[model samples]
Target: MPREITVALVQMAPELANPEANLRKMGDFVEKICTEQRTDLIVFPELSYTGTELGLKATDLAERVPGHATNYLAKRANEFNSYVVFGLVIKEKVESILYNGVVCLGPEGDVVTDYRKV
Candidate 1:
């Protein structure tokens, strides 16, 4: 038999510039989905953590890899025993440098992949 995977795509309107609110909303979605069905992975839209059209505020809103946004989602992944993928603004170690990136968290709440948009 071929292997199978269950994936859920979440289309959400995240509050602009508010990572905390977005994370909470995403967490609710995750809980709701996982409660209702079996899911191996859940994916959110680009800029799901930070809304689009950021302009200069993007810099201020950018998060470090393994930062608040990822950590928050990772915990949810662990809670629901599912993989989660989402997009956010990432800040580099070098000050003021940032990238558009996607992070994937495993079921154990560990980061599996972090891909920066080219």
Candidate 2:
């Protein structure tokens, strides 16, 4: 029989006013999930990073598309050889504002898809 892939859903809260702390918190949660006895896919919260902070008038709260947040998530995913989905802030050089975004990572440590939420 083929092996079944187990999935893990991590639900947690992060400290306020500290990006580094939040990122590290999420990263650690992901690490623990992958380290469990068995797990294949790990899906995080929609606004995993930046606590899904969205600007009312501007997107500045978001991170640039394919920006640091995505890069960070990529590194974490690569380390565990598991798929992950998380949300974050996406900022664009074209504009000074940031927007909410999401990214999906494959077991190969490559980004499979990304999206910007308006």
Candidate 3:
């Protein structure tokens, strides 16, 4: 038998500096997509959790990996039994250091892979 998978590409406008609101929006999209079809993976645009224009305030908007955003998305992933991929501003443990990062969450609500934009 041939292997197959369903993927969802989400396009939306993220509210600047409001991670919580963005997360809610993302969760809504996931729920809507998963409800409509059986999806294996969902992909969101870059900086999906934070708006594109983040001047110097990007630092304040930055969060650690497995932080609020990932945790929130993970629940949805597990609930829907699908993988979720999205971008966010990641804060380093040393503080003051941040990167544009992408995360992939497994169907079990675990971090599968994390990549930082170069």
Candidate 4:
């Protein structure tokens, strides 16, 4: 028999340049979804943290993998025992280098992997 996966696709507008607020909103969605039903995976839109039109400001908001945003979502994934995936601005060791990336948090609340937009 083929296994079934319950995936939740969240479509919301992220606050511009306000990652904290965006994170809170994301958390609310996670809680609500988990409360309503079992979710195997949750996916959020691209640029879900800082919103798309950031232009140069994206550099300022970029963060490293396993950073605050990922950590926050990981907690939610662990709490709900589900996998969560979201988009974020990622920064490498070099402050100037950044990537439009997506992070996948496992049910264990750990970062499973990240994919960068080409």
Residue-level lDDT of model 1, residues 47-107, one tens digit each, is 9999988999999999988999899889999999999999999989985888999999999
Model 3 over residues 12-109: C-alpha lDDT tens digits? 99998888899899999999999999999999999999877898989889989889999999999999999999999989897788889999999999
lDDT of 4 by residue, 23-107 (tens): 9999899999999999999999998987888899999999999999999999999999999999989999999988999999999
The lDDT of model 3 is 0.93
Q: Which regions in candidate 3 have their CA more than 4 angstroms from the true location?
A: none
- The list of candidate 2 runs beyond 4 A from truth reads 1-3, 53-61, 96-98
Q: Lowest summed-lDDT stretch of 10 residues in model 4?
A: 47-56
lDDT of 4: 0.94
- Worst 10 contiguous positions by lDDT, candidate 2: 52-61
Model 3 TM-score on a 0 to 1 scale: 0.96
Model 2 lDDT per residue over 1-118, tens place:
9888888888877443356777888788878888874567788777767664344523544666566766787788888888888877666776765556678887777889888877
For each of the candidates, the C-alpha root-mean-square deviation to the true structure, in angstroms, is 0.8, 2.8, 0.9, 0.7
The superposed Cα distance between candidate 3 and the true structure at residue 68, in angstroms, equals 0.6
Candidate 1 lDDT (Cα, whole model)?
A: 0.94
